[model samples]
Every structure is written in structure tokens, then in C-alpha cells.
Target: MHSKRIRAILAPVATAALVLASGAAAVTAAAPAQALENGVARTPPMGWNSWNTFGCNISESLIKQMADAIVNSGMRDLGYQYVVVDDCWMNSTRDSAGNLQANSSRFPSGMKALGDYLHGKGLKFGIYQAPLDKTCAQYFNSYPGATGAQGHEVQDARQFAAWGVDYLKYDWCSPSGTIDDQVRTFAKMRDALASSGRQILYSINSNSVHDKTGPRRNWGDIANIWRTTEDITNEWDTGQTNGYPMGIQNIVNVTVPLASYAKPGAFIDPDMMEIGRGGMTDTEMRSHFALWAMMASPLIMGNDVRTMDSATQTILKNANLIAINQDTLGLQATQISNDGTRRVLAKKLSNGDVAVALFNQSGSTTTISTTASAIGKSGSSFTLTDAWTNATTSSTGSISAGVPAHGTVVYRVSGGGTVTPSPTPSSTPSSTLVSAASGRCLDVPNSSTTNGTQPVIWDCNGQANQRWTFSGQSIQALGKCLDAPSGATAGTKVQIWDCNGGTNQQWNLTAEGTIRSVQFSNLCLDVYNNNTANGTTVILWTCGSAANQRWSRV
Candidate 1:
């Protein structure tokens, strides 16, 4: 299924490349000559797009109503400034002189008048276009033979700027061209917007299919926010579609690896959101919002602002979460741990705090946790505040919570930035791993001298494996490192291995009496399934405060 999708997208691109190469001069001639240093979009853009909710149904009246609702609903005050018209706004064809025209039937007052109205409401106006000869929604566009901005880049940009457009969303509907061709076309638009004497936010959508590790252009160099995934749908979980249909989770997976490309002036977009829509619950909305913020993604709301409920309003207006998103540091979060059923993500905030999210991906509710050490903060204590509930707590080491199925618990953890050194680094501390619940020692099966021996809980027999030495971030059992296997996931059996400096072998004994692994960033040494019986097996899982995950070294 995935291969066919890739092939379908690539074929057009390859054909377009040959055509573009043949007419290179004509394409270059269309590029704008003048340039302006438009350094807008220092922070991630927050606005409302007309595509996800309205699609091809956008009109001048709907836009005006949305603008009014944005102000009255306090969205404008919350820093959502742009009112963007996505696609299908253009007329059937350009004028005799070749200028794009608004659909007379839908936008009789024209785009300029609409931009003026939005500006009067203190909102910026955004316009959308396709770089190709036609957009994906070409059938609904202005005219039968309507051309995109491909051969009229400068002219279209000037028209948009003359219409008082403050933002430009350039889509890659017909993505056929070489890497240089794509870059030149995008740079042409960027140069055009710059020369238009309008400091418009240049947003490019190269389409997510081009995002894989390949000879693709660096969109971050020119775009304020570039779509990194498929278009989002109004679903909480995975959505089914004929083409690429993305839900919140699917988008996050696509966004996980593109963190380094994002910064103050640019962000990796996961496409427009479906917040406040009927397909998802409030809990799912909260999760979606938190993840987007943590990723430093553009918050382009895609719901009918005039009709959403109060819960949706509150989630959208979350000032604290928004602040994290617009932080001057502009660092996107990365997935710290994912063991199939549960996952943990952490982002570093500008104020020396970490925004951590524990997500329950399973169908059933599960206990999840992560320690301060797991997030690069060891020794010091942390104070956590639930971003959604405003609940507060402090932990010297680990934080745990019972997360509902498909729900997320986001916390802002402060302090714990400095790692306190051991009283004596040269001295290795030997201790017995006493389970906080069973009061038994962590024992190597049968006191075996072989490698790959799994660990277990047994009566305090003072065996070599039970009597472990901790030093230099490694816990050694019988001269081998107590370890979780490489690429270990939840329920992967824990065993002993030769003391290699791998992350799976590195351990940190936290102040809260939980063991953390550097390799599994947000995972902890946990007893399998709350089992306290002898030989119950030990493994790495999402951190939790349950007795099974708690241990004391003595």
C-alpha cells in the first residue's frame, strides 16, 4: 500500500523534472527580479486555515464571519492573527493581462476588499496557491485552463501583495522537477514575496512525500512553516483514506525526526489541525495541542471558529502551552521513549524547564512514568505541573501517572538541570537491589556465570548478582553490566551483558528509588506487570510509581 503511494507521487515528479529541464530558461525568466529582507515569522505562526474544515466551500462572508469570531472568541487576543484562505478562491481564469482573479460568484467584493476587512479587525490575511500549472483542487478553481504560479511567480506574488495578502501558502500539487528546480521555484516565490514590498509570511508545502532522506531541498531556508506530513483529518487515531490521511499520532511520527531543521524563523509543519471537530473528544484535542506545541509546530486552527464549544475554546486558548511553543529558543521536542503501547516525549523550554508528555497508545489505560535523569537531568529535584489540569507535584527523581487510553498527561518539570557528582567518582558503591514492594534482592538466575542471564527477584541471599556495584553510570552485576538488550522494548527481558559503554548498559539510581536507563530515555527498570513473585522477570517499561517499578539500593 505504501509503495504504491510512493510510486504514484514520484512518477509525476519525474515527468515534471524532464519538462522543467527542457524549459529551464522560461522558468527562470518568470522568477521575480527584486528582493526584500522580509524577516517576519520569528515565532511559530498561529492562525486559522480554511481547508481542513471548509475545503472548497470558503466564501467572502464565511471569512468575514470567522474574522469576527476570532476577535469575539479571544483568539485574536491569544495571538492568532492570520485569517488564511486556503484553495479554490481563484476565478476560472486570469484576466486578459494575465492576473489571477477571485471567484466573482463567491468573492464579489474581491480579495483586496476582504483583506481590508480582516485588517480592520486587526487580523492578517493569508492567500494560498499551487506552484504547478494547476492545484489539486483545479476543478473548483477560477477557470478551465487556470495556470498556477509556475510561469507567473512574480506576477502572482505582486497581485497577492497588492491585494494586501500578509501570508502566502505555496503548495506543491504538481511536484515534478529536480531538487534544483524545486528550490529555484520556491526561491522564485520567496524572492517575489520579498520584492512585493509586503513582509508576507512565506509558507511552503513541498508535500510530505518529499520529506524522506533523499536529494530534497532544505525548505526551512525559505519557508516560515513547511508541511512535513500528509494533510490531517478529523480523527484522533489513525484515519483511513484513498490518499494519505493523517491523524494526530500519525503526524507526530512524521514530525519526530525533523527537529533540528526547526528554529525561530522556520518550523516543520504537520499540516492543519482538526481541533474542535466532532471526530475527536476533548481529551484527544488536549493531546493534539500539547504535542503540536512541544514540536514547535505552527498552530493553524482548522475548525469553524464560530461554532466550536467551550472546551475546544479553552484548549485552543491555553496561553501557557502557547508560550512554550513561541519560546525564543525555538527547540522542537523529540521522542525519548516508545515501547509500542506507551511513549514519552520531552522538550527543553527556554526557561530551563522540560515539557514532558506521557502518552498511552494502548486500548486500555496504563501506568506510565519517566525520571529526571532520563531527560538529561540527574541528582537535582523537580517540580512538575500538569499542563492541562494545573495540578502540581514535586519529585526528586521520577514522575508517574495513570494515563487513560489514547490520552496524554503533559507536565512542565522545573529544576534538575545540574547533575550532582557522586561523593567519590573513583569509589564504586556496592549494594543490594531490594524491591520496594517484595523486599527481595534482584538476583541473577541460579547465580549463573554465563552471559545473557536474566535477572529475577529472590530472597536476600547476598549472591554476586544480588550484590551489585554501581559506579560511573553503570551498575555491574558479577563483573557484567546489568542491562536491557539492544533495541529493547516494553516487556523485553532484562539480562546481564559484558560491561560495554552502550546506553542500554548505562544506569542511573534516582533519588526517588527508581532505576533509569540512558538508552531508553523515558523508561525505567520495572518488574513485569506488577509481579512480585520470585523469577517474575525484570524489564524496561514506561516509568510508573507502582510498587513493581520502585526499588531501593541498600
Candidate 2:
């Protein structure tokens, strides 16, 4: 099994505790992140990261060697670029001039030199950092100590860009108490990057993949990518790792996380890929790439790109899936069924067609049938095009197909069918609920014009802002709510503040659609005055349906 690291930072869970304490959890504002360029990913990103095989053992020599390998191995031709360096490159001390420097022992030639080499080799370079004082490494906090430096922090990003960095993996640590601070920190770098006149891709890193915080407004402006898991470990033997493990579980883990994000330029990242690292079989790897593609995730290959085998190459080069992901229209799939396994994958293709995958994960292969009504709207019909077999099938009510154990069948369905606005949903007698969303989900009102004023939740009156949206899976109130005390904790008492479209502002509604904390689920959707007094200070309470705590949206 590959080594999976679960050390990403998390917001405190106390605020969420109050949510469960109240027994009422309702998400009024929950949606996915918007695409980077309003386009979906055609294929999963095809690139290399240093985490899978190298762990904390990476160095300049190893990086260059892998770059050489990627080229010689023909990975570049298959669209793999970006030679990413994970953690451990930072140093315990910065130079006297107040400049953050790379660890000389590990990178003697310096990151700039390394960046030059990658650029010369026709590849991009990526680095990592956290929003808080330190990374999970817990050594030299990037945020300087009492003997402070210019705390603006944009200078650090400039240094990386000056060294020719094309990607930045910004982790959320050293909680400022709100996703806003987390996202704003990255925004600092974003401005720095844009001004650097460099096209550096920014990535946000957090620990939870299933949290239900609302959207981080303007997230597209801050990052090109964001992590949806705490950390992806190497493969495990008994009782697999969290999120989805490498083999067998990749299909389940990866797909479940996909539905939340998966918008256009801004793809939802399920951490790095652990392909060719030996925990998974060739079929599993294919499944990994396929799932990422269908979900429109960035295809960052976590395996040693330089040493990948021929079969890995074949899997990474699935042009059909890649094309679909890279298509200009970035609309991603909304899971028809969020059962995790026994699942269906889908997306709207560029040619105005919808692609879907039916997967049977039960031990015994089973035939799964989905009527048109089951797959889409009630009045519309669609023609199903199976991308897996290159066949076209049509259905008016639903479509059914037989699949093997741990296997899938993908299709492209198109028609002039009507797209139904999703039905107003009903609450289930939920057996399991993960509360405590990292960024407190601001309950939004239909049309409040005050930007700096605290946000309040009115009934679902259907105004653009009140109709909270999600980037990836994180939910966000209109760009007008506040994350109380700036960065709210799980049980952190919340008050509406002016919204800034920051991480603190965004949230992800879970499969059950319960509004929970983004960093943890120990909290639940809560309402003001248990759905009573209009200004009862709505905070996360344990999920229970008191009218004040109850919320519904289609």
C-alpha cells in the first residue's frame, strides 16, 4: 500500500458541537465551486508530484531525474507536465535580509535553478505552503515569529514566482479562524502572482473532503485548484485509509469526492494521484484516471512520472476521457445517487451532450437500470452514447446496463430534452451525519443589498445571492455574509458579517445535503431561534429538524 499522509490542518470543531447540541442542522446556502474558465476538464490532469514515491525524501537531483524520466519515458508527449515538489523543501531559518530561503541541504542549487531546469525541459514547477504559521511539517512557520518580517506574505509568493514557479499548493493551517483568512491569504499570492507577470497556478489545501461549508466566493480568483482531502496516504492493508484508498477503493473514494467540485478551470483536486506506486493494479489505475476525468478533476499524477510503465502511459493517454474533461463547458455532474458505491457518473459534454457512467461495486456484478426520469428531468428524453463501447442508446424514461464487480460503463447521452430544475428535496431519517463545516455556512437572505452588514437567512425566496452556490463542493453565502470572529471554530459562535467571497464564506453541502462544517462534520446546519426569532444568532447545532433548524431547497 502507498503511504497516505493525513496531516493537513483543520479548523476547530467547537462551533459545530453547538450545531449538534441544538439537534437542528439545515443548509440554506450550499453549492459547488465555479469553473476556472467556465470550462470542464477534458481529462484528469496528467502530471507528476513528488509525494507518492519520494515522500519527504525529495531533492534537486531526484526532481531533475524525474523530469528527465518524464521526457525520456514519453510522458510529456502524453500531456504530463508540472514537476511538483511536495513538503519538506522549507528551511528552519531565513536569511538575514528577511528572505525565506529553501533548505540548502536538500536543494543546494536553489529552487530558482530547479525551476530553470524544468522550464528548459519544457515542464512547469509547483511548490507548497500553508496559510497558517506552519505547514504540517511544523518546523519553520512560513509566517515569521516575534522578530517579524513584512507580514503581507505576498513577498513569499513573489519569491516562488521569481524562481519561475507555475503552481502553488497553498495549505490551510494556522487557522485565522475563518476560511476567508485562509482564502484571502492565497488571494495575496494571487495578486502577487498576477503582478509578477507569471502564470502561476494556485492550489488550496485543506483536510476534509466531505465537509459542507458554503462556497468561498471569488474562489476562482484565488486558486486554480484546491484539495478536498486531509491527506492521501499510501495504500493500506486492513481497514483502508480515509477519503478513498488507492486500489479497489479509488473508484469509491474518488467519485464520492468528485460531485462536490468538478467545475471548469477550477477543478476539484482529491489530493495527488498515487498511480504506479504498487498499491493498485493496472485496472485500478485506469479506474482512477477514468473517475477523475468523469469528475473533471485536475489529473496530477502522484506516481513517479519518470518511472511510470507502458500500461500507465496507456491509461493516462485515454484521449476520449481527456477530451471530455478539457472541454470548454465546465459544467460537472450532480450525482443522481450519492450512494458512494452502486454509483453513476455523469457530465455535460462539449457537443451539448451529457456523458454518464454506471458503476456496479457490489461483490457480485449487478445490472443497474436508470430511467430517463431517474437519470434526468421528468418531461425530457435523451439519447445515450456509451463512450466506453462507442455505442448510442436512447431512453425516454430511464436507461439500464449490466456492469461487473468493481467495474464501470461510461456513456455520452444527448437530446433536446428539458432539464428540470431539481425538485425541492425532503429530509431522510439520516443514520449518519458529518457536521462541523470548516468555513461557517452563512445562512443567506433572498435580497439583502448590504455588503458589509452581517447576513441573515430569510425563507428560500430565490434571489441570485440568496441562492448560494458552490465551487467544487464548498458552499458559500452571497458575497455578503460574515464568518464570526473572522475564522469560526466548530462550535464557534457565528454572527453574520459582510461577505467577501472568501473560504470562510463558502461551504459544501454533503450528499445528505446537511449543512455541516467544512473542516469537520461534528457540527450541523442550525437556524436562528430554532427557526424561531428572526435574529436568534443562527449557529451550527447538531442536526435536528426544529422549524428554525429546518431548511429545504431543490
Best by TM-score: 1
- Total residue pair clashes for candidate 2: 101
Runs off by more than 4 Å, candidate 1 = 1-37, 139-146, 208-217, 239-243, 418-554
* Per-residue error (Å), model 2, residue 550: 8.0
User: Which consecutive 10 residues in model 2 have the weakest lDDT in total?
Assistant: 423-432
Which 10 consecutive positions of candidate 1 have the poorest summed lDDT?
A: 24-33
Best by lDDT: 1
- For model 1, what is the C-alpha lDDT against the true structure? 0.72
Tell me how far the alpha carbon of residue 137 in candidate 2 is from the true structure, in angstroms, after superposition.
2.8
For candidate 1, write residues 140-242 as lDDT tens digits. Answer: 3323444588789999989988999999988876534545566777889988888888789988776533532111333677777777655677777553323
Writing each residue's lDDT as its tens digit, candidate 2 over 238-294 gives: 133232333334333333433545555576665676657776556556666666667
